[model samples]
Each structure stands twice: as C-alpha cells, then as structure tokens.
Target: MLRRVDSWTRTLRHAKPSSSESVRLVVERLSHEGRGVVRPGGKVGFVAGALPGESIEARLVERHRRFDEYRLLDVVEASPRRVTPACPIVERCGGCDLQHLDHDAQLDHKTAVLRELMSRTAGLEPAVPEAPLRSPPFGYRRRARLAWHVPRRGAPRLGFRQAGSREIVALAACPVLDPVLASLPGRLQPVLASLRRPRQLGHVELTVSESGDGRPWPVLYLHLVEALAAEDRARVAGFAAAEGAYLYLGLADQRAECVYRPEPQAPGYLLPESGLRLTFEPGDFLQGNAAVNRAMVRRVVEWLSGDGVRRVVDAFCGLGNFALPLAAAGLAVEGYEGDAALVDRARRNAADLGLDDRARFSVRDLDADAGLPDGVDAVLLDPPRTGAAALAAALAARPVPVVAYVSCAPATLTRDAAVLAGAGYRLERLAAVDMFPQTAHIEAMALFTR
Candidate 1:
C-alpha cells in the first residue's frame, strides 16, 4: 500500500508564505482519514478542517510527489451539511474530526467508508442492515486520557495533543466525553499545575459508568512517570473525595496505586434488553459509547440466537462482555481470550450471573489457535484492531454453520472475509455503527453463513 515517492518532490516541501500561492478549489470528497479531497494544479490535495462540497482557498503546507497537503484559510462556499462545531477548541484540540459536520451525515460517511473498504479490499459488496446502529454524536465517550504538557516559560497546558503533533492544546472542556468526565480538564487544570512534582506527572485518564439513569459517574486515573510526593498524594486524595470520584495513580509498568480508594471501582453498565450488567475496571477495554455498545450486544445476541443456535464459540471474548449477554439469551457459549485476568473476570462474571454452566470463558491465544473449538456449531468473534486473520483461516478450512464477526477495522475485517469467501462462506449481513462519532474510525459487524 505504500509507494516510493520521488526525491524531487522533497525540494518544494512547505512553501514560504511570501512565495506560496493560495488556490481556490472545490472540495471533491472526503479521504478515508476525513480530510477534504481536492485537485489543485492536477495534484491530489488533502485539506483538513474542510468538508465536502465546500469551496476553499488553501495554501500549500506540505507537498509530496503523490499528494499535497493544504491548509484551509477561507471557505468560499460551504456544504449544507456543515454545522458549527460544538467544542470551542475542537479544531485545535485534536479530539474530533467531524464535529463540524451534521451527526447524521457523519453516520452516512462511516457507512460509505465501510462499504468502500469492503469492495476495494475484499472484492465484495455486502448489504448494510436497514436498522442503523449508532449512539448520540456527543457526550457519549465514557473514557478519555488527557495529555499534560508543562512549559518552562509559560503556563502548563492540559488537554489533547495538537492535531497531528505532540504539542498540547489547552482546553476548557470536551463535548465528546461524558459530561461528568468532560469537566475534569477544566477542574483539574489548577490542581494539576500546582502539584509539587509537576514534572513527574504524566497525564490524567477519566473513566465513567453508564448509569442507566442517563447520567455518568466517573473515576479518575492519574498516570505518573515518577513517584508522587506525599503532599501531592494527599492533595489528590482530597480532590478525589471532594469530587466524589475515586483517583488511581498508575506507573510506567502499568502497576497502579490508589490515592483515595484502596481499589479501583469496577463500574457496571446494564444491558437492559439482555438483563445483564457488564463490569469493567478503570483500564479495562469497553466500548466507548454505552448506548451503541448495548445496541451492538443486542444485535449480536439477536443474530446468534435467531436460528435457535445451540452452541456458539466466542473468540477473543473480553470480560464476558458479549458472551454473558448471549448466554443470558439461553444459548450455550464457550468464550476464549488471551488475557488471563480478563479470562478470570469472564468466568467470575459467568458464575455470578448463574450462567457458569451455559457460558464458560478460558484463556487461549486466538492468534495461535490451530482450529475451531470442538462441539460449537456456530462462531462469534469480536477481535481487536489487529483482527482475527489466523482464526479466520482456521474457520475457513473447517466451515461452521454460522459466523458473526465484530470488527474495529474494516480493512482487516475484509481481509479475513476474503478467506471466508474462499471457503464458501457467504457474506450475508454487514453493518457500520458510529460507536465513535466525530472521528474517522468506524465499528462494523458482519454475519457470514455457509
């Protein structure tokens, strides 16, 4: 996918402003990364902070022989889908990309991207489900890690890193975060900067529970590169008690020490339809959007148990997040995961839910699996970003009746889909959900049948 660029292009990298010429071009479309695509002087131009169907005047910021990067100065004409961004510093905060576009339009764009990736990468065109899966476009993210940057000459900055750079951009609040967690940056600004060991402080992470009452309660993680001073620890503990949210201090080795609370609170979110509550720790991996996650699990169980599936294999299952719900639907499920801690939590969750006999989770390396689990008639895979390539190959050789794969990367999903296709599995149903809105990323689900 990577091609060699000619050395000749490097000479005219960033044209000096005095010598640089601004070009007026109509925004043609959006790149996979959500940048505006255009053609200026017959060269491919990518302009960030610009939307499709917008005419903009941009100066050349960086140039390559294949594509040129432009900095948008003025929008001569704007698209009807364009809307004012919700966050004041959204353009610079580097947290979100599509905040300026309509929420519905963002969903449409995600679906299109998935469709395009499938066709281009897998040579298949699968139908998207009629019922679109998505959550609220804003204030849906349950977790956020803010970068802390201190300057020798000026005030410290606490926010996300600048767009495409390591420099931090100060922020008052982030709309994408759950409001309870969103208020941390603004509230902790003074407190963090005033700490005795400011240089030792790394960053702050906010995690929250999706309380079914439509409110979020948070627990903060204070990541530290060095040891925290006793005085600073006391202040953080006071801040934690005052804020009514527990604080945890983490070291470089991933080992953590609690400040206010002795243990990190494992927040549980209720999957109302399945009558299940999924609990996860502060650093545990859970879907970012609570509403959409519940929807996704609902959809998965619906697909898994629709045909009266007897036994299903849940690969790469983490903390019984998916397997528990499916088992609650009265299906026999065997869940496999790589993380021993997550495997323990999954088994504990199964026992606590009184579904231990129906749902069992064990530690297994999915990447190295030689074959599908014995006795399972159907399969459900919720793989990480790297995807289930080897597992897909294994499944391909030994065909199963049904396979439902949830993926975070479309390219990887399709690459695995091709293997399934070669083994006579039909790509039956595919859908894209905006689990993470305002960003270019999309979460997808696909059903395959032999």
Candidate 2:
C-alpha cells in the first residue's frame, strides 16, 4: 500500500517546477543581492522585485540543483517601504535595482549586508559601526555608458541594456544621471538615427565634470565598430558644437582622438574640501558619485590622521583620489598602482597641488608578492572587485599599525578581512557608503588595527 502524501509532501517529492507554474510564498528576507528569499516545501526560491515580510505569487524562470529563481507575477501582500520607481523603464533597464524600495530602506539594507558578510565570512565584528556615507538618491551618477543598437527594421535604439538580457531598452531620459546628462539620450537619438551608418556606432560614454568656476563640462566619447564617412563625421561634430560638449572618437586600436573641444584644458573635477583639482583622460577610472567620493576621502584622512601614523602606503591608488588628500593632511604617502598612465597622472596631480614633497606614486603589479614599504605605519587599500588577496597576504607578514580598506564588493572584502584577522588585527571601524544609490552594489570602508 502506498503511503498518503499531503500537498506539501507532493511538492517536495516532485521534480523542479515548470516555467509556467506559479507559486505563492511568503518572503523570509532579502539576499545579499537584494532578491527576496523564500522556502517553499524546503526548497529555496529567489524572487526578484519582492520585499521581506511580504507574500507574493511568482513563476519559476530558472532552476538549479539547490534553489530556484522566480520572477514576480503579483504582490499578494505589499510592504510599507515599497515606492514607485522614478524611471519609467526601471523594470526593464539594468542600470539600477532597489529603486522600488524606499531610499532609507536601501541604506539600511546595504549596511545590514555589509555587517552580515563580515560576521559570517570573517567571523569578526567592528568595534565601532559608523554611520553610512550617503548622497542624493537620484541624479548622483556623473559617469555612464549608454548602449547603441540598430535593428533590421526600426530606428536606431540607444539606452541601457535590458535586465538579464542582451536586448537594449531604449530610453529617452534617465533620472539617476547627472542633470547635465539626464536629457542627453533623447537629444542624441535623433542625431544617431539621422546617421547614414548608424549600425556602425557601438556605444557612447558620457562624463560630466565640474570646472573651478562651477560650470558643468560635458564630454562624450563615441565608440565606433567601423569608421564613419566624412559627411557623417561633420554631422557629429556639428551636433557636438551645438551642444557645447567635447567629443572624442574611439578608434579600432582602443585609442581616443579628440574631435571637438571648446576649451584648451582637459576635463577634471575640483575637490573643494581638499583644496585640490584632479584631471583625467577619456577612459580613466573615477568614482561615479562626486559627493560620496569627497566625503569618503575626508573620512579616510580623518581615520589615518595621528602623530603615530606618519608614513602610509596606498595600494591600488587611482590618480591620487585619496593619497593627495592624505598628503595634504600632513602625512607622508607612497601610492602604488598597476597602471603606468594612472601613476603618471597621480604624480602630475600631486605636483599641481604642491603635495609632491609629501606624496609619491609608482607603477607596480599589485597581484604579485610585493611586500609593504619600509617604515610604513599605516596602509590604505582600494583594490577592485577581486580584492587585494596577494597584498593582504604580504601585509600579514609585516603588519602595520593601522589599515583602512575601501571596498566596492563585500564578499571579497570579507575574504581579505579574514587574512588580516589571522595577523592579529582587530576590526575597529566599519561604514557602508552609498556610492551607487539605486543599485544593489555595496561600497564599504573597514578599519583594522593591531
């Protein structure tokens, strides 16, 4: 005789749900990536666009051995923190997530994720949990790359990529971009559609920098899959001239050629709080949010300031964003970067600010085992998403008094934090920074001290 199987037991015994099958589940909490987590018949389900403490009906989109991914069909119960997104195409555009959640709730979620990662991965907690560094929720992105696509039977499409797909979501305006660039896509679409060879256009990079006189300087870099005709070039130049924006063309060899510029000077931004100006090229790496970047720099200076902390080493320093400010705070700084061009730019920025005597830059492979500098009292780490694993191991051998780590990815940061913990360093301070406001990206700062 077969044993009686209840509905829940039937679900557990069955294979993966079909793509069209809809399941009603109560969300337990949010995952690190901001997706809602639920357990239906002991099987984990990740639902996008669902919030914690809410019930939702979702359809299975993808299946995995241990868990399943679902797309939200309807919110059976809505959370109080939910808000209507400002962007019309937010559901389709991959530019940002968490826009449907309240801005304050987003900050709380980021901070909780950072703390949870530290505890779970590193087995440690900060002695001082500092308040999050925040900027305006909208209009905070100063740099963006917009995609261009030309279909077989339609006008050229230009905007951000669609969520979880290669299809381009054509957008007229983006609210998260800086005011100078918010309406640029709408203006550029008509010009691009007018081009004889719009299919050859790959993408466009937009950057807005603030001049010393507080004027907005807009720069556009157009990537080309194939060379444009003479008339097409002239038309693009005329559009740039009319908008009073600098234009550059990206060649096949990855070189940028300036096509039009109203001023003789390169584009740059001023750190008025630090009393310094930094200039960068077309493809240079920069912090996307200007306000949070400045505040983060100031916080780093404050954390490393002391008579005991005289000499500091900045690993993975990009164009002296933090090193120059530390030097201005009366500390001797030695910055090492992997990019020779960025190192040269850092050196020039130091000299321009008259901090060359206090700050120095050198090109070195950070991934290799290069030991810490001699007589270094403190170290500041700002590595990429991969984190500074090799450097962390090297620092463990010759530990410093203070270590300040600024990370854009929390998982890697926790992995490196464990290395520091093994070196007898105590987690002293931690703060989550709201660099990318509407996205699920977490930027954090942690201080370790021996």
Candidate 3:
C-alpha cells in the first residue's frame, strides 16, 4: 500500500525504453509527494530527489500512454533553494523527503500542497492559515518504530528501512528522534548481537509518556517472533535500566505471554491543561509529536466550544482525546470508536477523571455506521488517512451548526469537506499543524459551519 521510489526503478529496468538515450530537462515545480515535475514529449516526468528550476539528465524509466516517469542521473544546474540535508544518512532513510529542501521552504511547499489538494479534490480553495502551527524542526518525534535485521552470519542491525527497499539502514542516532530514543539503536547493538536466535527479533517501538509529576518516562516495546527466555528477559530488563526506559516484551501470536510493568500502572502521558492523564496500550495509536498533539487538542476544544455546543459527538475518537476535553468544559460528549480495547480505555479514563457521567465512549465502526449519535449539537472527527467519507455523507442529510474535522490526509479531507459543503456547511477556519515537520506529512484542523 505504501508507495516507494524503488518500485519505479524496478519497472524501468524491466520495460523496454522508448529510446536507448535519455533527455535533459528543467524541473518546473514539485508535486505533492516532493518529486520534481517536468514535461517532455507532452508527458509529465516525475523526478525524485530533484528540485524545481534544476536541470537534470533523467533516464526514462517507464512510459505510459499519458505520461512517463524518470530516474535522475545527473544535475546540470541546481536550484538555489536546495541545501545539504541535515541527516547524514538522509539518502537511505526515506523517512524525510523534504530535508534537502530549505526548512522554511518546506513549510511553503506543504501549505501549497494542502491548498492545491483542497482545490482539486474538495472543489474549494481554503484560505491559507496565517502560519503553520510548528515547533522545533528536529527532535520532535515522541514515538518511533525501528526495524531489526540480522543476516545469516553477520552482526545484527537495528534502524529504519531503506528507501524503496526492505533492507535496513543501520544507524546509531537519528536527528529527528526524541532524546529518550535517539541513542537507543546504538545501545541495542550488544543485545541484538548476543541474542540466541537473532532471527526471532522483529522490531522495536519507542514511546515517551509524561508521568503525573510532568517528567518524561520512556518505554520500549520489543516485538519478537518467539517467547523470550528467562535469561533473555533479565538481559532485556538490565538493558532497559541502563537506557532509563521501562521494557515490555510481546510475541506475535501469543497474547498471554505479553508482559510489561503491570496493570493500572502502565506508561501514560498527562495533559495538565485539561487535568487529564491518558494511559494507552503499547500497540495503540497515538500522535507522533507530543507538543503538536497537545496544541491540536486545545485548538479543537476552542473551536468546538466557540458556538456554545453543549452536546457533541467525537467520531473515531481514540482514548477520549477530544471528548474528554469537551466534557471537561461541561459539554456532554459521546465518543465513538471501532476498537473495543480503546473504547474501554477511554471509558476508564473518564471514570478515573470523575467525568464518566458526561464523557460516554461507545465501540462502533465509524466507517460502517451510517447513523450518528442523537441529541448532539456538534460533531468532532479524527479519522484515519482513508478519511471519514461515509460519516461525512451521513451527516450531510442531517446538518449541524458546527462540524470540526481533524485530518491527516489532505486528499480525503478535502473529499469529505466537499460533501459537507454540499450539505450547506461552509469552511470557516483552517489551521495547518506541522505534526511531522521534517517529513511531507501535514495534519490540519478545519471548522465547517452551516
């Protein structure tokens, strides 16, 4: 499902080239995915790693009836906006595609991408936000997944997957990693190298949660193919102590064998502003950036409460992120989620906070359900990348005064926005949040009112 540049290379290598020779062209502009666009023979050429206004000799990799793709060979002229990437292994990491582009310019490209997508897909051009909600460009990620690889006879390695390939790019520290996890890959070398069956290791998940006292506590969840031996557990626990992180071991097929700190004392993060601390399962989904997520929640409450919305439904709500905040403000909130485990967690969170009466969480699939909660004046959506297309259509027939949509996928967001517009709702405010600044991903919160 994930697209990669290596797939283009493979297709280019297998197909017969229109000509044995290649052509040189100037990059016109960048596409939404950070590829440079060039038109040759009336066919759009997507050149990865090439910037606009740069001249490059590209080999025709694939030729379709309407357009073609190219592999960048050599740059004859470089764009002035280009600069050296911050990460030494940026070429292989594939995690940050816009690192080579100027930092400030990346923001511009993202904003432009958002605007273009809205116009093309949603048929409405939203007014650009005054500026993107941003934080430090680096060291902002509080969650990361590292792939583990071990050759038949070579030393085992831990890091991220290579661009367009399944191979692992070994590394010690990543610039964008949170401080708690920045040095973990290097520190795990001894553990991975000494494992009895290295092939049984899968990957590592690093998460940082804020304690009740406002201190950051790092947690490590190890994904293994087989059970961890008694000796191996001691070794892992020792490694966790040395790294100042709590450790948890989970097997792919064995749920009963999964072990961590214990029940009721799981790793958790606190939102002091809302007077709430949420504990999530290690495998549950949470926003990657800590600072941005808090700000996003605050913004959502501000928007939802502006028009005196006393009753609201938080669709696709996970762990009561939005529902709890709104309920705290005296609004009766009904949060709907597909995962029963997360719904239980959300209910438990409300009960712990003494808001169980007002903050009600239900387990239901938003994608499948057509009818929404009754007696709600407003709706808050935080769906996955596929977007809330079905929910948006359902709400169209029953218009509300306020609809606050939080989206990570601009294309799908705009598509849903179009549906909401047809239902007499107009876009009121749009704020771009740099959830993952170094990468091309952009998260935004938009308000639609009738």
Candidate 4:
C-alpha cells in the first residue's frame, strides 16, 4: 500500500530529499512510528509525534544521508492547551510521550492515526473504517520496570530510560504510577546504600494488585553483582518493613545476594472493573495503562451486550484477563494461553474469584494447530507486537460472529486487518487509548464482525 512517488516528482526542488535541507515546518500528521511528518516545501521530515497542524522547531535525529530524518527538538509554540506533564522526569523518561497533550486530544490523535494507517498502510478505504472504542488514559498501567543505579555523584536513581536513548533518567517521582509504588525510590535508596558497592545494582520490578487495598507493591528483584553482607541482610529486612517492599535478594541473579530478605513474591495484577485478574512474574507481559484497560474491558462488555454471544474463545488469553471477566458475566469462556504457568494461574484466579464455573483455561502454542472449541460465538484476541495472523486465519474459516482484536502495535494490526478483510470479517471498530502518556506507545482495540 505504499504510495509510489514518481522519480520526476523527486527531482522537483521542493520534493528533493537531502539531510541538510532545514526548514521550520508545521507538523501536519503523525506516522505509524509515532513521529510527526512535516511537509517542508516538498520533501517530508519525520519528527517525533508532535500534534498535527502545530508549528514547532525540530532537529534532525537521524538521516538516511540520502533522505530527510529529524526529531522534535523544542516546542517553542506548544499548543496553549498543552499542560505541564505530571511525571517529574517527563522530559527525560522514555516510558511515555503524549502526557503533555490533553488526554482527550491524545486519544483523538491515536484514533485518527489508526484509521489513517488502515487506509495508507493496508490500502483500506477511509469511508469503510470502523468506529473506535475509547479508554481511560491514566492510572491503568499495572506493570513496569525500573532501572537500578547507585548514588555516587548524586542520589541513587530508579526510573525509566530517556527517550530515544538507553541512558537512565533520574526521576523524583512518576505521577502516573500507583501512589504506593511511587514512594519506593525514596525508601529504596537507603536500603541499597548499605551494599558494598550500591551503584552496581541493576533493575527493579514493580506490579500493583487490585486486591485488598489496591496497593502497588514491588516484588523487588535486585540485580547485584556481588554477595550481601550479614549486616546487609538485616538492613534489607528493615528496609522491606519500612518501605513496604517485599525484598528478594538474588543469590545467583541480580537480587539473590541478601540472605536476610524475605520470600520472593510473584508479580501479579488484577483488573477488578472487568471482574478479571492477571498474574505475571517479573518481566512478563501486562498492559502499560490500567485505566485504559478498564475502558477496553468495558467496551468489550458493551459489545457483548448486543452480540448474543454465548460460547466465547479468547485466543492468546493472558491469565484470563478478558475471558474470566466475560465468563463471570454469564458467558461461557474458553481461554487459551501459550504459557502453561499462566494457564494454571488463570485457573486459580478464576476459582478464587468464584468465576471458575463459567471460565476455563488451556495451554496451547497459538503458532501451532489452533484446536478450537466448536460452536463458539466469538473470538477475542490480544496478541503481542506481531499480532495474531494464524488465529485470524482460523477465525476467518470458523463461524465466529464477532471478533475483538486488541493490539499494542498498529502496523501488525493493519496486516492482520487486511487478512481478516479478505476472509470476510469486516473491520467494525478501532479505539485508541493513551496508555503510556508522554511516550509514543499506542494501545488500540479493533473489532471485526462478519
């Protein structure tokens, strides 16, 4: 679907491609990579996703040498409506990028981009596009990784990387995070300070649970290069109590050095709004935005309300995040996951939530034979970055009347969208959620119905 530009057009002075050609151009549109495109005379300069129609100064971030490449450098005339970002390290933290824009505006940009991608990238007609579903933009992320660095020249820091770089960004606090975990940095430094060489620490894992008081606790995974002293063990225990973080010293890996650390707790998070819960160990998959997740669940439920779906198959179901909630709502749900551990955990969660009767879990590699349950009314899939190509092919041949495809990446979704369109499933809805604010990541939900 790439539009082939004529070589003659390329020779035009305005359309000439060069790295040194610089001009302050208005951001006309956002590309799939979350960069803004500027029509400087004729050639296009891809800037980091700045708002469309907004005039901003940008510098070249990369150049093909033969082609124009640039990154947004400054927002001198930031949209008056642009609000100050909530995260103290918003300028440096690589985790999010759209926080400066109003939440609603971000949602709008994401929605339009998805639609445009479908039209431009997949050759789909704009008029034939689906209605998009919207989700809450904040406090929805249940999983995140924090980098570990000891304080020598400055305070020990734990936060995300800077945008477009691997360099760790020092942060005072992350506003989008659950309040419980946000206070961790202050308390964690003192605990790590006792280590012989504190700066050698590597990483931290944080996950929030919806149970009990809805606290965001660290399943503290410390990556240390050396063993902990006996005094360090006692210090770790005291720090866990004081910081409310469950400490696990890596004796072999990064956190095993502390002998006095308590038992390690697995990283798990719950989605109460959907009557569902997902359990994952450190570094596993979980949605970045929590509020948007609730909104996504609500949207699915709303669609189900009218679909008359009974037998449901959730392909690539992660810990029954969607299947369990749907089952709890009276739909018989058969959930599938690639990981056996996740399958077992999903079953346990269903039993604990009293939703076992309606929900069931199975472990199957989705890339292999998709042995589906017969007489299924719908198929819900939340695939990884690659999207669900095989599952889409299977569903195309099945009698599934409704299909909900949730994707974190749009390009792959569009590829699968083309395949689905060929298989008779019509693109019905595409909703964008600002899950990682101040960052380029976009979470989208697409519904296909035959």
Q: Evaluated with TM-score, which candidate comes out highest?
A: 2
For residues 100-163, what per-residue lDDT tens digits would candidate 3 score against the true structure?
A: 6887877888888877777777767554354677767888898989888888767788888777
Lowest summed lDDT window (length 10), candidate 1: 2-11
Clashes of 1: 0
Q: After the best TM-score superposition of candidate 3, give how far the Cα of residue 166 lies from its true spot, in angstroms.
A: 1.0
Q: How large an RMSD does model 4 have?
A: 7.2
> Could you give the C-alpha RMSD of every candidate to the true structure, in order shown?
5.3, 5.7, 4.1, 7.2
Q: Can you rank all candidates by lDDT, best first?
A: 2, 1, 3, 4
As for TM-score, the candidate ahead, 2 or 4, is 2
Across 118-176, the per-residue lDDT of candidate 4 in tens digits comes to 76765665333544444445554555677876645876666777665666776556666
TM-score of 4: 0.81
What is the C-alpha local distance difference test score of each model? 0.80, 0.87, 0.80, 0.66
Point out the higher-scoring one by TM-score: 1 or 4. 1
